[model samples]
Target: MSLSMILPMSAFALAASISPGPVNLVCLSSGTRYRLSQGLIFVTGATLGFIALFIAIGLGLYSAMNVMPGLQALLRWAGVAFLVYLSYRLAVDDGRLTEGDTHKAPGFMTGAVMQWLNPKAWLASASGIGAYTSGNDLQQVLIFASLYMPICWLSLASWVYAGAFLRRYVQRPQVLKAINRILAALLLASCVYLVLE
Candidate 1:
């Protein structure tokens, strides 16, 4: 691919990868509630989700999904329900860290599974594949996948770690509550968009 295409594609991927969504919020919450390592685990899961999504997209699953109304509806509803459930949990969570909660980081597999149900993630990946995938051969697709995963992993992990670090500076109840409220609202709003989209 030419530099012109590569640059724009990279920008698109980076923007989508770093943007605020339910997954990002969950990672931030995980970081704040537990530790940075836990937050990274969530990032790992999300990365795997993206990898799987890209593979499926490469294999024409998304194209198939687009033609099947029933499958599309199922994915949409599942994403909506999952986001709402997560938001409710965040909204009411006391922000109280249990003893040794640092050791309780989320598992990578769980994070990966969560991404499957994330509407924003599906939308973003579909968008990325449409906009970025230029090469047609197996090697080219593999190259695309190889380059995409680590960039995604690092970008997301950084956001989660930033959240964990920020938590140290805002150890007041009011501030934490405000943060949680903001995140919950963002997640819910995203869910509304996902359901409608």
Candidate 2:
């Protein structure tokens, strides 16, 4: 790829990664409850998941599924279900910060699997690959993945730290409730977008 292509692609990837979405919310919650080390694991897993997603899309799997409206619907429902589950957990969190309150950071395998069920992850990966990838050249796809995934990882970390910084102020019951509600609403909106799309 030309320098022109690479720079623009990288910029696009970074913007997409940094945008507010389900994964970022989850990372934020994780960071607030736990430590950055655990939050970074989530970030790493998510980044690898995006890299794998780019590979799958490059292999034409996403396009094949894209052409099948039924498959798309199935994917949408699956994403909605997963998001609802996540939102419920967050919304009902008790106003306590006991030791071991945080769940374990999902492993790389879980993160990779969640990509298949996360609508935002799908949309972002599809958008990045669709906009930047040229032809089916594996090398180019790998190049894109290599450059993009680290941006995603770092962007997620930034959000996690931002959340951690805000956690002190937001841990108050009313503030946490509002934050949880916002997350739930966003997840619901994501679900609606998936079905409508």
Q: Tens digits of per-residue lDDT for model 1 on 1-197?
A: 66776677667767877887777788887767776767887798889888887777766777898899899899788878878877887788676666476544556876787778777667776777766775344555565677678878887887788788878887776677777777888889988787667
lDDT tens string, model 2, 74-180? Answer: 87787788888877877776545544644644455655666778877777777777777766767888888888888888888898898678777666766766676
Question: Which 10 consecutive positions of candidate 1 have the poorest summed lDDT?
Answer: 134-143
Q: How much is 21 displaced in model 2, in angstroms? A: 1.4
For model 1, the superposed segments whose C-alpha errors exceed 4 Å read: 1-5, 102-106, 134-136
How far in Å is the alpha carbon of 37 misplaced in model 2? 2.2
How many backbone overlaps does candidate 1 show? 1
As a whole number from 0 to 100, the lDDT of residue 147 in candidate 1 is 68
Each model's C-alpha lDDT?
Answer: 0.75, 0.76
